[model samples]
Target: MTPAPRDRILDATLTCVARVGLGKTTLDDVAREAGLARATLYRYFPGKQPLISALVAREAARLGADLLEATAACRTLEDAVVELVTTAVASLEAHAALQYVLLVEPEVLLPYLAFRRADDFLREASALVAPALEAFLPSDRVARAAEWLVRVVQSYACSPTAEVDLNDPVSVRVLVTEFVLPGLVPSNMLGVTS
Candidate 1:
């Protein structure tokens, strides 16, 4: 079945946002892209901020699903971190919504995708990496660790020390494991042998 006009508008806008950036995308652009009238665009979006909010929300849900799937196979906490790092870096390179969040509207990512309390965001994030992290971190720290991973990935992507290779997703993945993951581990165990 064909999607509703609102959904169609969103789809077209997402494609445009991914390609031209959310700041540059216009109602006219979305209308042309969606094959709708400008007035019709207003019928759905009302304004740019509403459209942007919908786009960001939809993208967050999509990425959350992807993150859940990618980390499902993880067997250990380090493995979970590795999978999350790999998947997140790779997603940033491929997904338009993530591109918008990472490259254009970073504030969208700041909210962390929890429809409920911000803490729910941490719980959802932890579920993504339960395989590896369930064993490594204490119960109380699991959610906190999840939030940390999310922030670390964004920082890594935005870091100026070395640019992430858009084509080589592993470059950022490796960077995450080497630099960020170690810090997430507790310091009291540092003296212990691996």
Candidate 2:
């Protein structure tokens, strides 16, 4: 299905930002990319900040959906964590706009990720993982697990101190199984009764 005009404008904005970095991208550049007049762009976004905010919101929703879909079939907490981390790392690595912001204009995204709206991002991310975790965790624990998963994935994606390759599915699964799963899953679930 074809995306709506506003979505098209947001896509154009991302393209513009990716091409010229956020500080250098202008409304005129977005309008040209969207194939709309500058006046029409203003009619839709009103200003640059709103446009950038909308773009970030859209990307966040897309990432949430991607995470849920990637882990939909997970039957165990271990499987879910593996799916979540691998999918998140791969998705963040593949996102052109995100990579552009991180590489060329870290300041443009640092506020959203680390400061101003960081809590909002964490809440949204936790909610996204809640459904997948529900099968293996109680309601109270689900939020904590999801939050931890998001933090770990973000840390690994942003900065890796280890030699493990996040993009490698086998390596990610092994790392999660060996290190993360033992803490997240109950002993009973792993067939070890106390």
Candidate 3:
């Protein structure tokens, strides 16, 4: 089955972005990548900002769906959290366009990561991740925990740490045990004392 024109355009946009970076990827590039006319591309997206926005929305939805599915089989909250982090990290690492932006044109993300925009983006991310966490955390704690979890996953995926490599399951377990689980799970469950 073929994807709709908009989907095709967005996919082509990512291909172009991955190849040339977002700043250098013009509508002509995306149009050519999609094998569609420039007029057809404009018919779907009036401008570059709108096209970028649609692409971001599409990717976010895809990530959210993947996360929900990946964590669905976990038997415990700790397992769920571990799966969440590992899955999210894996997905982020697999995104070519995003990886390119982060590695080659990090400044492209600066505006979104700053002040008010940061909060909005975090809130949106929290909402996407919150559903996967609901089964593991209390209703009231879910949102806050999701926000924190998103922050942790994003931070680790973006900057990484020598102490914990999210790509490694064993290391992810250690991270969940010593850091993540301790926060989401009660101290008694973790056998910890102040």
Candidate 4:
């Protein structure tokens, strides 16, 4: 299926980022991937920061849906949380927007990593993870739990494992099963959680 205009820009941005890194992902490269002219891209994005912001918004929306669905389907809060965190990490690894932001402009990841909000962009991310957490965990514990899960997600994001190696389902699964799941549950259940 043809990607939508916003998606087209994101796809192009990822492609450009992968090829030349964020520093070289020019408007022309983005336009070429979107199959739109440079002028057309500019009609939407006045400049690179605008384009990057749009891409971040698009990715956040997609991830919000994926996380909510994963969270709702789980039988328990623990299961839901693990599924939610793993889904996010996997999505980041798969989505070029996530990688581009992580690799190119790390400040973009401050919300996920640091949860700072000098601007409101990161708030959408909290909206995505908060509902599931609220469903089972008390409101008081929600922030800390989400913060912990975010760290786990970022751990995988910055894993020393080469992209190809970490791409393996076994390696990805191990991260959650060994590291994340245990951490989520108290030490007693750590053995049984598996």
Candidate 5:
């Protein structure tokens, strides 16, 4: 089955962005990569910014789907969280366009990741993650816990530390056990009855 024109355009945009940083990518470039005319591209997306915004939204949805799939088979919340963090780290690291942008055009992302705009990113990410956590967290507590998890995962993912390696399962499990789980699940729940 063929991808829809919009998806094809976004995929082509990612390829073009990966080849050349976002700053250098042009609509002509995307059109060429997509094998579509510049006019057709324009018909779908009015302008460059709109195209980029659509691409970002598509990627976020993809990430959300991937996270849900990764956590689906986990029998415990701890396992789910470990899978979530690990999958997020791997996904971000493996995204060619995103890695290229981060390496060469970080300023493009700064507006969304920093300052007041960051709250929007946090809110969106929290919403994406909150549903997955619903099984483990009370309905009232899920949003805050998801936001905190996003903040922690984002911090470690964006500016990694020597003390904790997000790629290492054991290290991630330890971080979850020591920090994440304790915050999400109360001591009363985590404590052994015996």
Candidate 6:
């Protein structure tokens, strides 16, 4: 299927961001890349910030869906959390535009990393994980656990520590099971809950 105009614009924006970095990419660049006039681009995205925001939201949704699919077979809460974190980190690391923005133009992302946008990411991530968590935790606890998982995943993405091997699935799974699961799941239930 042909992509919508908005999607084309976002794709162009990401391409431009990857090439020039978000700090330098402009509406003109995105419009040219999308094969649209500046006015047409404006119709889809009024300004650069809104366009970037849309791109971020779209990418995050895609990643969240991928996480859900990747963990669909998980039989336990720990397994799900480990899969979620590992998948999220891997996805973020593989996103070229996102990596460019984070590594070379972090300031472009700083404003969106604040309370409102951060909460948006957290809410989406929480929603994605909530269903898996429902079998083992209360609704409120599930939400909190999801939020914690999102925070930890984001932390690793933004500033990975040398101690952990993010590339190794077994290493990530062990780390989450040992350090993260205990905090999110009550000790008594952790051993048996799925």
The candidate 4 region of ten consecutive residues with least summed lDDT is: 115-124
Q: How does residue 171 of candidate 3 score in lDDT?
A: 91
Q: Is candidate 1 or candidate 6 better by lDDT?
A: 6
lDDT of 3 by residue, 1-194 (tens): 98999999999999999998999999999999999999999999999999999999999999999989998888777787888888988898899999999989998897777687899989999998999888766678789889888888878866778988888888988887788777865676543211
Candidate 1 residues lying further than 4 Å off, grouped into runs, are 96-138, 160-194
Q: Which stretches of candidate 2 lie over 4 Å from their true place?
A: 112-121, 189-194
TM value for model 3: 0.91
Q: What is the C-alpha lDDT of each candidate?
A: 0.68, 0.79, 0.87, 0.67, 0.89, 0.80
Which residue pairs clash in candidate 5?
none
Question: What is the number of backbone collisions in each predicted candidate, taken in the order shown?
Answer: 3, 0, 0, 0, 0, 0
Question: What are the models' TM-scores?
Answer: 0.65, 0.86, 0.91, 0.66, 0.94, 0.85
Worst window of 10 by summed lDDT in candidate 2:
185-194
The positional error of residue 42 in candidate 5, measured at the CA in angstroms, is 1.1
Model 6: residues with Cα > 4 Å off, grouped in runs: 111-136
What is the overall TM-score of model 4 with all chains considered together? 0.66
- lDDT for predicted candidate 5 compared with the true structure: 0.89
Candidate 4's C-alpha lDDT? 0.67
lDDT of 1 by residue, 151-171 (tens): 665455555345555235466
Against the true structure, whose lDDT is highest? 5
lDDT, candidate 2, at 191 = 32
Error of 2 at 45 (Å): 0.9
Number of clashes in model 2? 0
Model 6 residue 20 CA deviation (Å) reads: 0.4
Better of 4 and 6 by TM-score: 6
**Pairs that collide, model 2:** none
